[model samples]
Target: MAITIALAGNPNSGKSTLFNSLTGSNQYVGNWPGVTVEQKTGKYKKDKEVHFTDLPGIYSLSPYTLEEVVSRDYLVNERPDVIIDVVDATNIERNLFLATQLLELGIPVVIALNMMDVVRKNNDFIDIKKLEKDLGCKIVEISALKNENIDKLIETAKSVAGQKKMTYQEFEEDVEKYIKEIEEFSVIKDNPAKRWLAVKLFEQDEKIMKEFPLYGKETRRLEEIIEEAEEKYDDDGEGIITDGRYNFVSNVTKDTVKKGRKGMTTSDKIDRIVTNRFLSIPIFVGVITLVYIIAINFVGGPVTDWVNDVFFTEIIGENFRGFLENAGTSEFLTSLLVDGIIAGVGAVLGFLPVIAVLFLFIAILEDIGYMSRIAFILDRVFRKFGLSGKSFIPILMGTGCSVPAIMGTRTIESDNDRRMTIMTASFMPCGAKLDVIAMFAAFLGGSWWYAPIWYFGGIMAVVVSGIILKKTKYFSGDPAPFVMELPEYHMPSARNIFKATWFRCKAFIVKAGTVILLATVAVFLLKSISLDGHFVDFNADPEDSILAGFGKIIAPIFAPLGFGDWMASVATILGLVAKEIVVGTYGVLAGIGEVGAEDSSMVALVASKFSVASAFAFVFFNQLTVPCFAATGAIKEEMGSNKWFGLAIGYQLLFSYTVAFMIYQFGRVIEGGSFNLMTGLAVVVLFIYGYLLFRKDRSKLENKNFSNKENDEVVKYESN
Candidate 1:
């Protein structure tokens, strides 16, 4: 018989590593029904008959967050035969809070003591036999990242699959008396989960109460039991039960966990320096700046040059054109094949080196667990602006791509914060926008700090937007409480890093091959054919074509931003299809067929058609505008309402345009140019922006800081 086992854990507990080791390439990923949160399931690599479900990482079975609800529902409703709960061995006291709840489901449970290597490294020891006996579960010590004893862990889980076990830990005697009364008299009779359900009732869990609501005399009795417990314990029902669970876990840990070196672990020492209040921000800035320098200007520069110069312009364009001419191909066909497809797609693909290198550094930071500290450090800054520290996760993720970043907002518990995050995340320059930044930097002979400046600029935009919106009725709430666990520093797993890089790079390559290729063909055809439908050389005349006429029609809308040239307008319009297509469009227009930031033809195109201020404005417009087609779809799905999606898109467009306008007019004045009507308008816009930014909070909700409900001292290891 096939054994169904659910793998569950707290975030950063090595659950994901263990799942990948067990399932390998046999897994399938999708959303849980009716929700956008990802669900992963697979059959065991060693034995296909043994099925495994990787449940969402959550701290407890409480229905407070979507992840917790999804996990709790699946365990209670689906009733998986057995569970492998991955617990961080170094913080077992906190992780056991989840273990206590999982034990009540009447399913066999196996505790996978992850990161045991770290425990051993510290000269600490755990009494597994005693721990197992107390928790009523089997225990296995394994390092998931190293694939140590993984087979043994699976074997033990399967061996106990169908057997039933109940949690042995009990609350205080008086609390247990009321819980038993509910189980025996009011809650489900003859149910295996009756003990768990009765406890849920006693605690007055909102979701559970709604699911199995009582009426008449039952309601009064339920209220009596809860009020009596609250009066006796001097706490709410949830708090009382929470304290009971913590007491139990504390006792168990004292008996099973043995201390060795107690001064401070290596991670604690590193955090003292890296997370120091005075030095943290500067250190982060230095780390990020150094990372981009190595990726963009040093290592990635040479390879990008080769891809743009020798590979695309010399080899593909030259060879293809020569072959087409020899075969007596028509000019239209030759131009379409060489200049249209090869030129445009190659221009975008040349930046793959820069993108892949940057993603590698990000992957390393995430795998080594430093990314969590970033949230903690930035929380103090973000909270004052009415934005949650959780906002940084999506904003940082947006530096890679906005699609996944928007989806990541699901972790935020508040609707207003999630909506605000989805709207502003596009301000971050994504992998595609990096091409725009690189192109413009080379166009203007910008310094090594150019690319990094755009990243920090994006963060500033999010902060400024948060401040403005906090004074409005729609987005005025105190920042959500930020709580995260800092995992111990360790060597990054090579396999994990490689997988992250490959997946992200593959998406970029695929889009260039498909979306940009087709869009470039259309752009070339429209520019090559005249309004009268006659074939003309777009490189020779350019103004007589349909695309030119269309660009001229809409060019005035961006005239204030200074890039009023037809080709610049054409490039910005095509950017809506995909941000990288803007580069491809410029390449196709220049008739160079392959463009890079360092290419003389692209630099000449900008110098002839744009001033320095106009070029900066053009780059800023593309950097912060409404994202490409795919990301807009993600925004729509995340918002889950057409009204909100429209509002988000409208807001993004207005924000991008106003910022670009201000930059150009102010820059023109800075460059000793004549002031005009547009300059006066820019000043007015600046005044309005400053007023909104400095306005007082107008939130309808109470001003009190509402953090996570759990006591941080007790559940210190739980992370989103």
Candidate 2:
């Protein structure tokens, strides 16, 4: 028989590291059953028969969130042969709460005490043998990161899987006499771990309490026992069970665990500097700036330029066009292949290195545990703006892709909070938006501030949106308190960072090569084809072509935002496939395709065509749009309706356009520059919308017969 082993543990107990080590390249990540929460499962490296299911890192089997529910459901329905409960050796007292709960499930469990190296370094000691005796399970020490003693852990897991069933008895007192009575009832006599089941029932765990049907007549007796226990404890079932588990964990820890009198370890000392109360913000800014400079300027620029100019612009583009011309290939087909597909999609794909580097840094921060500390440090600041501190992770990850960042909103528990997070998550420039930013940075403006400015624009949008939305009646709740387990700081594995970077970069390539490529070819066909034999050069003048004509109609609409150029206008039309392509489209249509060199040459080409103010406005519009296909799909999935998704997109477009229009019009005046008539009108219209957004729309009242304040508030809230 194939043995199924479930690895269960608290978050940051080195569970993921252990899973990565045991599975190596054998693991697959996907959804668990019907839930949106991601599930990771893999076969043991050498032991194919010993399949491992990596359960979500959770505190207990409580059904409060999708993760906990999925984990609890899997354990009850699948009933793995053995569970390797990974625990942090340094934080055994807190970690054992989950361990103790897992034991009650009546499955054979082996304690994989991870991070033993950290424990030893901290001068803390754990009596492994004593812990085994206390929990009635095998205890094995392993450093999942270092790959130490992992083989022994697997061996012990195999042994436990083959052995007869062993169940853990509760170590804490039974405050409820009825809980004990329920365990003793005749209906529960056959249960292997009646005491554990009884505790869960008393704790009123919906999963367990609802299972009383299996007990039949004894179910009534169980309920009576639970009532008596509830009265005696003077607390609900969940609280009672929670307190009991904590009490038991505390006793076990007191007896077997000891902390050295040592002041601070090397990591703690480093953390003080990195996560310092006052200096942390400056340090974070400095670190992020350094990351962007290295990635965009040093690494991404050279690599991306090579991919764009060398591979596409020169080699493939010129060679292919020349070959086709020599062979007397049709003009339409040549344009479609060279400019439409290659220049359009290839331009987007060229920025993969920049996005990959950004994602790599994010993964490093998360894996090393600094991400959580950043959250804790920023919680107070973020809360002041009516956004949760947890929102920082999604926004930070948004630097890579907004799809996952929006999906990360599922981690937020409050309904209003989740909605606000989803709305602002895409405000951060995602990998897709990087194409536009890089394009503008290279072509329109050449300054180190270009990249950082886009980043600050994204962040400012979030903060400003939060403040504006909070003042409204619909989103007027205080920010939810942030709660999360702080994982021990450790050296991040290069392998993990590389894997994460590759994953995001690969997604970008697939999207550009497939979706963006098809869209660009379509645009090319529309622009190049004509019934007459007149050879119209679409590149010289885009206005006379189909794409240009289409953009011309919309150009007047966006004239107020300062970018009425057909190239900029048409690029926005193609932005629906992905945002970054807008910049690449601009680069091609702006007649910068002939630039030979990488960084400086490309910058020179862009600067000659557009001003800095217009460039900033262009990037702003792209930043505030309803993201790409992937992110839109994610929002729909997370919100569970098209209505919410539509609202999210509509709000973003309105907000983005208003901001861009303001900056372009008002900013020009501040710079002592003359403004266009349409731009001034656009600004005036936005002012009205801004006023209506924050205040009552009294115009609707004249037509309506009557309205309730509650109904009006609801309508206003949903509109926002």
Candidate 3:
């Protein structure tokens, strides 16, 4: 039989490091299943036959959070042969709580005391024998990062998998009585040491109770015990169970562990400074500014430009155009390769360097555990606007792709918060948007700051919009309470960091190749086809051409926003396929042949018609609009109904239009003159939005039945 071993611990417990060390496979390292939360797993490299399941990192088995529930279900249902519970040796007291519950599952377990180096460095000591005696499990010391004693850990786990199962730690008199009573009805009744199941039954885990039915008297008996304990504990039965587990761990630690008599250490001292009440925010801003400067201005900008111009433009451009010229390729085929595919998707691919750098930094922050602090620091301020600090993660991820960013909203517990988060997450500039922003920056703004400015603008958009929406009837709610564990920081592995970079970069390429390919082909088809003796797109006036004809029909609609040019209209229409395609569409319409790095021919054409303000407005509109088709699908799946999906899309479009109108009108007004009477109508719309934004309460939209129920509850409770 294969020796099955499960690696388990709290988030950032070096579980991933240990798994990678043992498995040598980078199979799993995504933000989350449907959220920005990280997920990881791998199999042992040394012993492929020895199955290793890396369970999600969680604090405990209580179903208080989604991750905890998912983890608990896997452990209970899957029932691995042996569990190697990795404990952060430095934070043993807290880490042991999970281990204590794992012991109760009645599976053979070997405790891997991780971070022992840190423990020894801190002048702390844990009597391994004493700990083993107290917890009734084998304990092995190992440093997951340095790969020390890792082999010893695997050997011990293999040995234990072949060994007989161990019994759970005995509970207190009252807890033990209920344990016995519930065990009588449990499917694992033949095995009498299932202490945690009994406690879960007493705490009224519906899933557990359903699995093990009992007589009326027995059922009532369990309920009576749970109710009486709840009253005595002054908390819910679940809370009581949690308290019991922690208390048990505390007792075990008191005898075996000792801390050196010392003042605040280096880590604590640094934490005080970094996490300071007043200094943290400003410092964080400065840090972010510095990061952007390094990423966009210094590193990513030059490298991306090189990739765009040299690799994409010179190399790919020359070869593709040469092939077309040599083969006597048809104007349609030439345009498809040179304009549609190369220009559209290639434009987006140009910014891969910039995205890689940004994602690398994000991965580092996450691995080192600083990202959680970001949430904690922002929680209080964001709460006033009906969003939790947790909303920041999705917004941050949106800088890479809105598809995952929209999905990240699932982590938000409140349906209202989740919906609002989904609506706004994509407002932040993603990798696809970065290409457009980079294009404008290089071609229009003639400054490096422009790229970073777009990112900054996207972030500010979400925040300001969040604040406005919070006061509206549609978005009224209190932010969820913020509670999270701060894991001990560690130096991130190069392997893991690079793996993350590849993961995000791969997503970008996939979009460029697949979705953008289809969209470009569609654009080619639409722009080609017959009319007169001419290849209409190549020879005809842009206005009379197929793309131009469609744009002309919609051109008047966007005239108010200052981009009245038909090409701008066409680009916006193409944006429905993908946001990045707008830049590519510009290349095609400008009659630029395989647009290269040195080529500003198409950009000049766009500039002749559009002012800087109008260009910014155009970018802004696309940035905040209903995201790419993939994100829309994610919204539909996550919302789980078309009505809610429509609401999400409608709200996004409405918000995007409102902001674009404001920027165009307000900026134009300050610049003075050439304003039309329709500007007055836009001004009126702006006023209504202002009322929605600044109003003390959301009264106008509160009557809608689909308004967030959680937010309604919060509004009602707050009023009381």
Candidate 4:
């Protein structure tokens, strides 16, 4: 028979590291049975008969968060043959709460105490024998990160798999009374999860109550037992149970663990300045600005300049055109292949170096554990706007891609909060938009402030949107509580950082070769064909081409925000397909097809046609707009309906246009142009924004108007 093992633990306990080690490359990843939460199962590399399931990390076996529910449901329904409980040894007291609950399910469990290296370094010692005696389970101390004693851990777990069955931990006398009665009177007396079910019933868990059917009088009797216990403890059932578990964990740690003198660690010392209430926001802003400066201006800029100026413009374009013409190819086919596809795709690929640097910094922050601290520092401010730091995490995750960022909102408990996060998370410029940002920075002669301004401007938009929308009736509510474990700071792993950077850059390069290549060819055909359907030379009568006529029809819509020319208008519209293609479109329209067009490059070409005001507005609009089709599908899936998806897209477009309009009109005046009608209109837009920002919160209204299934389920979920 195949032996199934479930790995369960709290978040940040190094459970995933162990899973990766045990499974090697044999893992299979997919969704949970009926939910969107990810599920990972793999056959052990050493022994295929020993299958492992990596459960989502959770604090307790309660249906609190989606993760906890999925874990609890799997443990109960599947009843795996054994469990390896990965516990963070440095924080054993808090971690033991989950370990205590896991014992009650009657599955044989082996506690794999992780992070023992950190414990040893801190001068703390834990007695393994005493802990095993108290918890009545096998224990092994290992470091998942260093792969220390991993084989020993699995061997011990296999020995305890079916040979030993551990009973639930005993409670204090006061609580023992209710438990003894539950064992005698419970309906699931013969069930495998009898003890666990009995405890859930005593805690008055609604989900658990719904599961085990009890008639009217039987339910009232159980309620009486719960009420009496609550009266004695002076706490609700959930509180009473949670306190009991903590109390037991406290006793176990006190007896078996020896601690060193209390002093702040290095991570704690750094947090003092970085997380200081008054200085944190400014310090965060400074750090991000410095990162962008390094990536865009210092590190990635000179290389990209060479790629655009020397590589694409000099080598590829000139050589490819000459060779094609020499081979007796027609001018039309030669231009279509070289000018249309090569120039456009080359324009986007020129910025790949910058994206690699940006992704490297993102991976480093994640590995160093500062991302959690950033979220922690922002929680107070986020709460004031009817959101918590939980929403901000997904926004940070959007730095990679918007799909997973939108999907990350599932962990937020409130419907209003989840919907708001999903709507605004894409406001951040994803990896796809990094090229557009770099293009603008290059156009400005590689100005250091250009990238940071565009990057942080997107974050500020999310914050400001949250503040304004929280006042509306449809979204009025208290925010979801944010609970996160801030891990200790450490040096980033170079291997992990490079792996992350390569995957993101690889995806970008793949898209450039396929989607972007096709899109650029289509653009070339449109611009080369005239209104009467004959091929027209772009060097002569470029305005009479089909693309120019089509762009002319939609150019007036964007006139208020400047960039009313056909090229800029067409680029902005095509960005909806993929943001990277915006830079490609500019390359195509620059007329790089004609000889001697080399020195007047794409960025140089665009700069000659646009003033500073219109160019800045063009970049800013793409930064805040709905990212692409994939992200839109993510929004629709997470929002659960066409109505909410439509609202999200509508909000994004209107917000992007309004901000771009202000930037253009105010910027024009700042550049020494006299105030015009559009400048006065910008003032009116600012006044409307002030009204929205200062508005009072409205009462929560019935949400029956919009059909959202997640809304009803979220309302029913208990927030713990």
Candidate 5:
């Protein structure tokens, strides 16, 4: 039989580092069943039979969040052979809170005191033998990051698992007396942790109270006992139990742990500036700007140019065209192969280097713990717009992919905030959309600053949309309080950063081979066939193609946005399949066959088709529009209502269209162009948008019926 051990701990307690060290390369990651929370399991590096399940990093086994519920259910139902509770030795007090809860689950536990290097470096010491004696569990000190004493920790955990003996710790006298009484009177015989269940009963854990079988009179008597205890302690029953556990932890730590000087640690000194009130946002902006500048222009630009000019255009396209001509290939077939397929797919793939560099920079930021500080600094600003800083996490994740970002809203507790976040998260440009942005920036003179401009534009889209939606009745509500622990800032591990960047870039590459490939093929075929009769010849104008006919039907709708041409309309429509297809379709329609070393024809073709203002409008429209079908499905699943999903899609389309329209029409007006009907419509739309932006929130209106009530009466009514 496989020996199973579960790893549980508070968030940022080095639990992940320990799991990575123990499991090495033998790990599988997926979501917990029926929840979006991540679950990880792996086999020990040395012994394949020794399986380790890394439970979600949770502070306690309370059923408040999905992660907590999943962790609690797994521990109670699966009942691993041994529980390895990894605790951060530097922050032992807070970590011990979870350790104490894990010990109460009636399973043999081995405590892995992680980050001992940090502790030792700070001149702190923990008496391992004394801690083991006091906590009734085997203890091992190990630096998971440094791979120190890992073998001993694993051996000790396996031995404890083999013993299969439960470890119990005594609580306060009053709490212990009530727990024993409840256990004796309880009829839950199958539960191994009867005392723990009784303690949960006293703490008024709603899930336990609902699931555990107890007589009606016994339930009433249990509540009475809890109330009497609360009265005696001058605190709620849950608070009393929490205090008792802390008291026990204090006794253990006071005897076994030695503290070092703590005026200001390195992390604190850094946080003082990074998390400062006035400097935080500007610093964040500078960091993001620097990342984009380096990725798009400085490092990634030359590599992308080579892929496009040398690899795809000169080498692949020219050689294939030469071979086709030598083999007497049909003119139509040659056009389909070179002008249609390779051009379209290659246009998107040429930017793969840029995407990889961008993902690498973002991964480094995340690994260094600066991303969390971005959330911490933005919380106050988010609250003013009726959103919690927690919403920023999903928005940040959206930069990679909107599907996961939409699902990430599960962490936000408020329904209105979560739904609003789901609706707006896709406004951030995802990896697929980056191809379109890169192409547009290249068309607009290859300026590096366009990258940050579009990025900041996406963020502003999210923020402005958040503020607007909050005033509407469907989304109007106070956001939940933001509370999150800031992990200590440290140098990012190169291995972890590379792994993350590789995985993200690999996903993009896979999509390029699969979804983007299919979309490009379809676009090529559509543009190759002629509406006049049959397929078009090699030199035939693409305007007569079947795609142009369809594009003409939808072209009028985008006339106000200035890209009313058939090709631009067609590309915009195909973008719904995949955003990268927008650029791919342009490459196909431009028909710059057999691009040479200095291939400026395609860029010139795009420049001729769109002015700078219209190009910006086109990019903005695609960036802010409803995301691809996969993200829509996620929105539907997360919103749990087709009505809300439809509303979200409608909102995205309307907002993007309105913004794009204003950019083009008003831009033309500023250039001393003629004032047309479309320009007048843009003025009207702007006025309505401004009205909505400044509109009073109907939800905040006072009601006479409620306001007329006396304060004491209102208080009494609410209490009852």
Candidate 6:
């Protein structure tokens, strides 16, 4: 018979590392059915029949968060043969909190004490035998990172499979009386988890209460018991149980564990500076600026130039064109191969070096645990805008890709916060948009500061949008409390960093080959066919092309933002398909026979069509607009309401248009251009925007007044 083991733990407990060690390269990743939370399953390298499910890292089985609910549901319903609860040895007290809950599940479990090396380095000692006895489970010490005792841990878990275990800890007398009463109530008598269910009932778990039917008398009795207990303890039943569990864990640890000399550790010492109240934001900004400088200018720029100029332009384009001529290949076919496919896809692929470098740095930051600290440091600022620090996580992920970033909002518990996050997350420029930003930066004389301007611009857009959205009725409540465990800082694993970087780069490469290839082909075809409805030669003027006709129709809409030419309008429209296509579209529209390093001809062409002011406006529009169609689909799925999805897309379009419009018209005035109707419109937009931004939220005022009135009434009643 095949044995199934489920891995569960708190976040940053090294559970993922342990899973990677046991499973090696044999793993399948997907979402759990009907939910966006990721579910990973893999078979043991040594025995394929023995499978493992890596549950989302969660602190408890409470249904407070989506992750907790998914983990709890799987453990309760799927009932895997064995659960290997990976525990961080350095933080045994907090790690065992989840272990205590798992014990009540009636499923066999083994505690894998991970990071034992770190524990021993600190000179702390844990009595494994006593801990095992106290928790009523098998315990194995292992360094998941070093691959030590992994085999033993798996063997121990397999041995405990399918066996029932009971928890050694018990609740206080008041809580225990009702738990026993609930067990004998007979409604859930056949349930093997009667004791666990009874405790959940005492805690008044709404989900659990709705699951089972209770007699009216049993309900009243339970309510009365809970109220009396709450009155006696001056707290809710949930808090009482929580305090009791911690008390039990404290007793168990005091008896069995010995602490080393207490002092600030290395991680603490670093956090003191990196997470300082005044210096954190400036430090974060400096780090980000340095990353972009290295990726865009210093390292990735040279590599990208070579790939574009030598590899594609010289070798591929030149050699292919020469061969086609010698073989007398048809003119139309040559144009399609060189101008359509090569120019378009090559434009995107040229940025592969930049994307790789960026992903590598981001992966390193994440692996070294600095990303979580960024979230922690930004929580205060985020809460002021009515978003939890958790929202910043998706925004950070958005810097890589918006699809996963929007989906990452599933971790947020509040519906309002999740939706708001989904709406604003895409405002951050994604990896795909990097090429567009780079192209515009090159157009603006290749200054290094161009990249940071757009990068920070996207961030400011998100912040401003958050403030505006939170004041509205749809997203007016206070943000949920921010609580996240900061993992210990350690040396980044090169293997993991390379793997993460490779996956991100691979995804970009795949899109270039698939989605981008098809889109570019379509663009070439549209631009090649004449408006009079006949195929045309490459030498023909682009104004006669069908694409020009369509672009002309949309060009007037963008005239206010400058770059009203049909080609620029068409490229902006195509960007909605994929942001990189904006650059590819320009390459195709410019009709450059061979693209070179920096594609000076294409950049020169764009520069002629757009002044500095207009170019920056164009960049702002593309950067702030709704992300690609794939990301839109993700937003739709996450929002789960077409109405809300439409609202999100509409808001993004309106905001991008206003920002771009202001940049162009105001910019023209500054550059000695005439003030006209568009300038007046821009002034009006600025005024309205200022009013919305500075206006006090009427809802907050009303709430404050109502609160003061209630306080006054209370004081008057007390005086009486």
Give the runs in model 1 whose Cα sits over 4 Å from its true position. Answer: 165-167, 215-232, 593-599, 700-720
Tens-place lDDT digits, model 1, residues 535-562: 8854576788999999999999999999
Q: After superposition, which runs of candidate 3 have C-alpha atoms over 4 Å from their true positions?
A: 16-54, 120-123, 143-152, 162-164, 173-188, 191-193, 202-213, 216-243, 299-305, 319-336, 446-449, 467-475, 521-534, 537-541, 591-599, 698-720
Estimated TM-score for each candidate: 0.93, 0.87, 0.86, 0.92, 0.93, 0.94
Compared with the true structure, model 6 gives a TM-score of: 0.94
Tell me how far the alpha carbon of residue 557 in candidate 1 is from the true structure, in angstroms, after superposition: 1.0
Where does candidate 5 have its weakest 10-residue lDDT segment? 700-709
For candidate 5, list the clashing residue pairs, or say none: none
State the C-alpha lDDT per candidate: 0.86, 0.75, 0.75, 0.85, 0.84, 0.86
Better model by lDDT, 4 or 5? Answer: 4
Candidate 3 per-residue lDDT over residues 233-307, each given as its tens digit: 688877777777777888989999999747887667767977898988877676666666666766655676677
Cα lDDT over the full model 3 = 0.75
Report the candidate with higher lDDT, 3 versus 6.
6
Clash-forming residue pairs, model 2: 203-237, 443-606
Residue 42 local lDDT, model 5 = 97
Query: Which sections of candidate 6 miss by over 4 Å?
Result: 20-36, 172-178, 216-236, 592-599, 709-720
* TM-score of candidate 2 against the unseen true structure: 0.87
lDDT per residue for candidate 6 within 93-122, as digits (tens), equals 998889888888788889999989888888
Q: What is the C-alpha RMSD of each candidate to the true structure, in Å?
A: 5.8, 6.1, 5.1, 5.5, 2.8, 2.5
Q: Judged by lDDT against the true structure, how good is candidate 2?
A: 0.75
User: What is the TM-score (0 to 1) of candidate 5?
Assistant: 0.93
